[model samples]
Target: AYTVRESTVFYVRVPAPHARFATDLLCEVVGQPRLDPADVEIERGVILGELDGALDTPDDVVFMNLVEALFPGHPIGRETLGDPQSLVAMAAADIAGFHDRWYRPQNLVFAAAGALDHDEIAKTIDAHFDGRASGVRPERIAPGEALGSDKSAQRPIEQAYLALGWRGLTATDPDKVALAVLNHAFGDGPSSRLHEEIRERRGLAYEVSSSAASNLDAGTQTVYCATAPEHLDKVRRIIDEQIEAIVTDGIDDEELAVAQGYLTGSMLMALEDSSSRMSRLGSAVLTHGRAIPIFESLESIAKVTTDDVKRVAERIFGQQHVESIVSPDGDEFDDDDED
Candidate 1:
């Protein structure tokens, strides 16, 4: 599968015995893809359908609006699947040009995991991608200050969708790990503050969660929920209170330990799979310029103190945020509609 974000990644999973074949196929696909006009047209139709589907998904609409509000005119805020107009205007030549411009040897990293001979794999890769001319890596422009805007979309759905987004730490920030821990304790799972308070305690919403996505140069921390339209105000108010409480009082020792344990355990468990390990290797090198040892990452999580969490919380949550909502009420969603 391939993912397109601030960066584009193409990966394949194969048995160890077929490692060589996978390497050749991967290099060939990345290096000399045939952007056939017919194929491009077919994929264009597929993507257009996806765009339409996204519009119908309240969850997608809410977060898309939130990101746009957070970054405004920046590319980071733009929808990853792109808008319908742009996709329609695009052609095979445009795709080929993009591939030629960005898919350079210097801009690529090769990573593998599983029972494989490193030297042999390297030799195979070198043979497949030996003396390609290197091109300049594209320089990225950092996004300007985030906007604190409240935006909403009207839908015919019965449940209201709410999303809150803040400009968050970059992948390289020292406080990123702390932010992760805070996310877990604050809104990541059922044991999180948001889930326990909003769902378990108050029964305001059935689906509520928070996530942090840190990219090479930009990041976002977001809280999302889907609830009955009548409970929208209560849910929003609860989310705000939780954020304020975490920022002010901070998490206690027990909460910190629980968050840390969850993070560490999850990491260890994920790395057990070869595909996951390979992804970790490639993502680390692509994002941070090195494959950080798993042990070192675990160590960082282990050392996180409550002070660290509080400090990072202040750094992030103290900033202005963008709020986006999708509900049946249109602009009147925030009015006294809550019963």
Candidate 2:
């Protein structure tokens, strides 16, 4: 999908011998989509339904709200499933024009994984896609100020969903590895600090996790939690307290080692599958303009020292944060963004 903060990736996987056929098929579809008016209306209905379903889920709603509040005026902040009114107003001719303007050769990339002859595939691509003259990629949306203020909505639900987000390093930032280590140690899994404190010890939240999203030019680190409406205050406090402690005390050797191993091991394990490899290939290329081997990725993780993690933790978490709350009254959390 085309997005503001990240590159749009088109990917497909096929058996070794079927790679050429798959490439040819994808080109035909992209270069000449059958945009019948009937088909357009049908797809619009399907997409709108999916979007409506996503909004009903508390967590999804909270996350989408956070993205909107964080990247205001940017393409990333645009409605996830496109605007309902816009879709309804759109015509088949408009869709075709939009496609023609943006679906240029320069904007697309061809990538494959698994057993295949690179030369043969390249030749096949040239034969099938030749004369599809290269054109400029879609203009990247420049970022504006992130709305660091807190935003809350009244949802009349049993559980409250909260997301606390901070600006993060770009994909190629030197501290990216350290940031990954910081994320893993904070709340990536059951053993993470957020889970250990928010769920295991306090029994406050039913779900809690942290995520790092990096794009070509901008990035974010977010912590998500859902708990009984009554426990929302405690959950929010503990999250802030834990982050402050990390910035002040830093991570220990044991914690740092665990994070490094987990990060590297996960990368290694994912590469064993063709689907993972294909995704990694496309995303890596889009982010770094090249594919980084698994070993190189592991090495990068291994080199993230304790100090690196500590410094990055302080730098990222110390920024003004965007907080989002979805609860019955929108009255439980602070309206002011916290640092």
Candidate 3:
């Protein structure tokens, strides 16, 4: 679930022989989601429980808080999991309205993997979704502002969770490739600077990782970690020191090669399966309006240089950074709010 997907996708897989059934089933589900009043009521309860669960999870709360601070009033700030109040007020009509807005063929990308006849699949798709898929592209009801701020809240949790975020480059931007390289060397995996220094060396956190997320209009560069309430400041300082090193000294040749290899191998591993490839292509089209060739992606990562990474690091980390932390019963961050 913690993957690159934007929305909750509905996908069904079957053997090549049963591909037609899967196709037909998808069409039916999309065209009609079984929003019966009684079913809606039951699912509303289910969703509310999920939202409550998210609220109780310190990591989820802090991540959402960081997002809200980074992009206040934006759609991305809203928790994808429906909130309690909204779920209580929701009705079948609301679901229907959602379907009306974005379910059109123009806004959809149909991707499949495995062995199948292209012509036959086309015929089956036409038979099922031909003129039934309708509607024009929806226009923006509101625009997004990548405003940054510092925010924190107290909860009844054991450990303190913190998220450091910055305004990031969009997927289409040329700087994103270098940013990805920088992020990998910074905290993408156990071998990253943050993991090696914060968790393995200092034992300051149980969970520590950084990510570079690219959205439609903007992106988010973030580092998240959970630690003992008293250790939050130390962990933050360690992270800041690592960022400073990246921006100042820049990664050496060996580090650059390793980072590129890590990204390249990770990408190749993800695409080894058919479903992964389908999802990758489908999501790319959905997000950027076109699929980026795997070869092109690899080349971009390979071309990243130490200088390029330094430039990206300085540009990104130099932006307005929002630091959001959630502690169990601490007030240390209460008056530290700033942008």
Number of the top TM-score candidate: 1
> lDDT tens digits, residues 44-70, model 2?
898889877876776777877787778
| lDDT, residue 8, candidate 1 | 73
Itemize residue pairs with steric clashes in candidate 3.
none
Residue by residue across 204-296, what tens digits does model 1's lDDT show?
A: 899999999988888999999999888988898999999999999999999999999999999999988998998899889988899999999
TM-score of 1: 0.96
Off by over 4 Å in 3: 1-8, 141-148, 330-339
Candidate 1 collision pairs: none
- Identify the candidate with maximal lDDT: 1
> Would you give me the overall lDDT of model 3?
0.81
- Candidates in order, TM-scores: namely 0.96, 0.93, 0.92
lDDT for 118 in candidate 3 is 67
Off by over 4 Å in 2: 1-5, 146-148, 329-339
Candidate 3, 1-339: lDDT as tens digits: 222324557787678899888888887787667778899999888778887888777788888878878878777666787567788998898888888778777766777778877677778767766876577876644335557567787777789888999888876788988988898889988888999999999999989999998866778899999999889889989999998998898788988999999989989998778788878877888777888899998999989999999999999998778888888766565633321
Q: TM-score winner between 1 and 2, please give it.
A: 1
| Residue 45, candidate 1: alpha-carbon lDDT | 95
